[model samples]
Structures are given as C-alpha cells and as structure tokens.
Target: MPDPELPVITLEELGVLRAVHVRGTDSVEVELTPTYTGCPAIEAMSTDIERVLREHGMRKVSVHTVLSPAWSTDDISAEGRRKLREFGIAPPRVRQASGPKEPVAVELGPTRTSRPVAGPPELAPVPDPVCCPHCGSADTELLSRFSSTACKALRRCLACREPFDHFKEL
Candidate 1:
C-alpha cells in the first residue's frame, strides 16, 4: 500500500515492512519498523495493513513495531529512490559503505551562531549537498531541519529555485 504521507512509495519500498509470520494457521503477525521514533504514520500504516489482511479473510492480524537495529535511510529501495525523484522529492543520500568519513570537530573558538551555544560549535558535520530532485543540481540550501515529516527536511535548489522535501539520512 502507498504511504499516507508520501504516497509515491509503498510500505515495502520504504523498507518499513520488515517481516510477516503465520502462526497456528489461523493468525498472522507482521513486523514493522518506523522511519523514526514517534512516527505518526506508523499507526496509520499498521491499521492499513491489518485492514487489508482482514479483507483477505484473515481474522486475526497483528502488526508489531520493531525498534531494534533501527531504521536507516539506506533501507530505502532503489526503486523507492527513483520514485521519490520522479515525484519531485529529493531522496536521502545513500550512505557510504565505508561509513561517514567527516567528523564534526568541537571548535574551541567562537562560532557562527546568534545565541551562545552550550555544547560543540558544530552539532553536526557539514552535510553532503542535497541535490534538487527536479533539476538534479547539487546547488541546494537547507530551508529547515524539519519539513512535512520529521523524517524529511525542507530544501531549496539554487539552480532551479524550487523548494522540495528531502528524506533525512538515518
């Protein structure tokens, strides 16, 4: 089924449909992983899954949320990424197999911020450029840390002057 928010992708494409198990030939149990903690779409997805199963003549349907191992952006299928781009949304960058290389160093000097920060000057390392899904240009600027969903960030492409949502990494 298509995701309620991002209808361009399916639950399996989003990598949240972790597993399904048949128990005692009468009931079925589904395992799901949320994109992030406290994801609101999780409930809707679960309900949809249960309803669909029920329609298929399954009386007992259960959807169990899984948190262990966590959900990673890398879980997004290649088809999902293509779909996101086709739908004008920037998909999350594929994480390096070698893992993140750059580490945000704690600067002991004055940093660029309006308020006096308490912790490290840079809370996170400079993120890789979020390319424009429409123009496929790397010239983009982050508009907000959060967008329509917590799992996505708002970004504007400098090349095409278009605003789009980018699936957040991790």
Candidate 2:
C-alpha cells in the first residue's frame, strides 16, 4: 500500500500498515496506525486501502485506525530511511534514550552539600547535527522548525549552499 504523504515509500515501509485480517470469504479488515495523532493523510490512506481492496473484488472491506502504542520515527523501516534520503529529505536520527554524559560535580565555596536540579522530561530528542543531502556535508544550519510538511524542518548546507528538508524525529 502506498503512503499518502510520501508516495515513494509504501505503507509497510512507513510501518503504518499494522495487519490485514480476512474474515471468511469476501470480507477483509485492514489495521493502520497513524504516524502522528490527527495526521492529515490517515483518512486518505484508509480510503485508498478500501478502494484497492474493492477493486480486487472484495465485497466487504473495512479500515481500522489503532492509536495505542503511539508511532515513532523508529518505526520507519531501514528501506524507508534510505528512500527518504534519496528523495532529498534527510531521515530522522535514532533517538537517544538518555542525555549526553555529564561531568563529575565538585563542591566549592566551603559548602559540602550540592542539590540536584530537577526538570520535566524532554518530550522530543535534541536535534542531531544534520548532513546536507546535496553534498553530504555535516555543516548544516536549521533555517526554520517547519518545512513544507509538518514532520520536516527547513535546513541549509554550508558546503553546497543548498536548502533541504529534514525529517524531524518524533
């Protein structure tokens, strides 16, 4: 099945097509998970799936959306990432579970006690250094948070001086 957003990548490669259930003859149910909540392409994808199934002579076809176990950038297949990069969109970096290692703390000012600072957990990973899709240069700068699509961001490479879209990690 094709991805409505990125047509070059299939739904399977996008990791949204969860499963296909066939109930007896002439009945089929397709399970899908959206890349993000309230994704604009979800309804289009469902419609496409049903149309394809009907064209294949299925009398009854139902598309179900599953939201549990929210989708992540990790869900994108290796092939998908490769395709995305080849299409001039930088693929998301694998999210790090923990922040960078911190240096050992030292007590100063005759105070032996030091209190740890607490903050809310980060909702998303810090943006990784982006490489230019045109010249493969690591010296790229983010131009804007939003790109042509909601999931991407605008960036420019210092080497090639070319602007490109980066697929932001969820």
Error of 1 at 119 (Å): 19
Error of 1 at 14 (Å): 0.6
List residue ranges in candidate 1 displaced over 4 A.
24-26, 98-127
Show how many residue pairs clash in every candidate, following the order shown.
0, 0
The true-versus-predicted C-alpha distance at residue 132 of model 1, in Å, is 0.6
Q: Provide the lDDT at 143 for model 2.
A: 80
Off by over 4 Å in 2: 96-127
lDDT of 1 by residue, 21-131 (tens): 988666899999998889899999999999998898888999999997687888889999999999988999877555644432343333212333466767744546778
Q: Model 2: which residue pairs collide?
A: none
In TM-score terms, candidate 1 sits at 0.80
Lowest lDDT 10-mer window, candidate 2? 107-116
Per-residue error for 164 in candidate 1, Å, reads 0.9
For every model shown, what is its TM-score relative to the native structure?
0.80, 0.79
